[model samples]
Target: MKTILLPLLIGLMLVGCSSSPSLSNSSSLYQELNGQSGLERLVDAFIQEIAGDEQIFHYFAKSNVDRFREGFITHLCDVSDGPCEYQGDNMIDIHTGMKINEADFNRVVELLINAMEAEGIPYRTQNKLLARLAPLRPEIIHR
Candidate 1:
């Protein structure tokens, strides 16, 4: 009886595992944003907007815009559940010495939202991405 029940249980487990959905093929926020190329364009637009904004432009004045743009794209891709990995420093390590305050962080978020809108990404999708990024505030602000 024990041997028979064990085999039955094993078969049931295998069936359940095989019927489960594959997360890799699932529709992600990354796909919704049109994948890597779309993310690159969105990052470019966001960086441009940041450069022009008086409130946050000073933060980037001494930084490498091109490198930042690339890292930003990679970071956003990772955040949006894309296949790309981010090669840049983590949020706390990168922003530790920057002394970014709440207002500055908020301004950056606003600029990003505007940039997404300009790129024709829908509002719900923008919010989804923003929600994923919102957790980084502690590592980014007042640091």
Candidate 2:
């Protein structure tokens, strides 16, 4: 039993390692998002989706759309193994007075998902980005 289990575990580990992306290639694939250029387009799609939503547009009426958009792009790029640094307020502080609730956050996430789909980003890439951003839920959702 011990011998069989050991071989099985080793085989699993080899499979996992083989399927994983190399750090350098991952970084290069991230850079393919056109660095700032690709990020800019992604941000535009996400913002347009958000702005079109009647349920959420009011919340951003007075907000700096361009700045928020760029910040989001930077954050996404940085988290996706891209060569960029995000230098904005932390997630919690940024949404302090905005009173964003779970529903609102979810709506924004959905919009982001749609935007990613519209850009033809594969599901794996989308999931990778989402996984990185998921931890910010607690900080961004005020309610």
Q: Using TM-score as the measure, which candidate wins?
A: 1
Instruction: Please give each candidate's TM-score.
Output: 0.80, 0.76
Candidates' C-alpha lDDT? 0.90, 0.81
Give a tens-digit lDDT track for model 2, residues 19-86: 89985455654665556777778789989997899978998899898788778888887777787788
Q: Could you tell me the lDDT of residue 126 within candidate 2? A: 76
Q: Model 2, stretches more than 4 Å misplaced?
A: 1-29, 32-34
TM-score of 2: 0.76
The alpha-carbon deviation from the true structure for residue 56 of candidate 1, after best TM-score superposition, in angstroms, is 0.4
Stretch of 10 with least lDDT, candidate 2: 23-32
Clashing pairs in 2: none
lDDT of 1 by residue, 45-134 (tens): 898899899999998999998899888988988898789899888899999888998899999999999899989998878999999999
**Model 1 misplaced regions, further than 4 Å:** 1-26
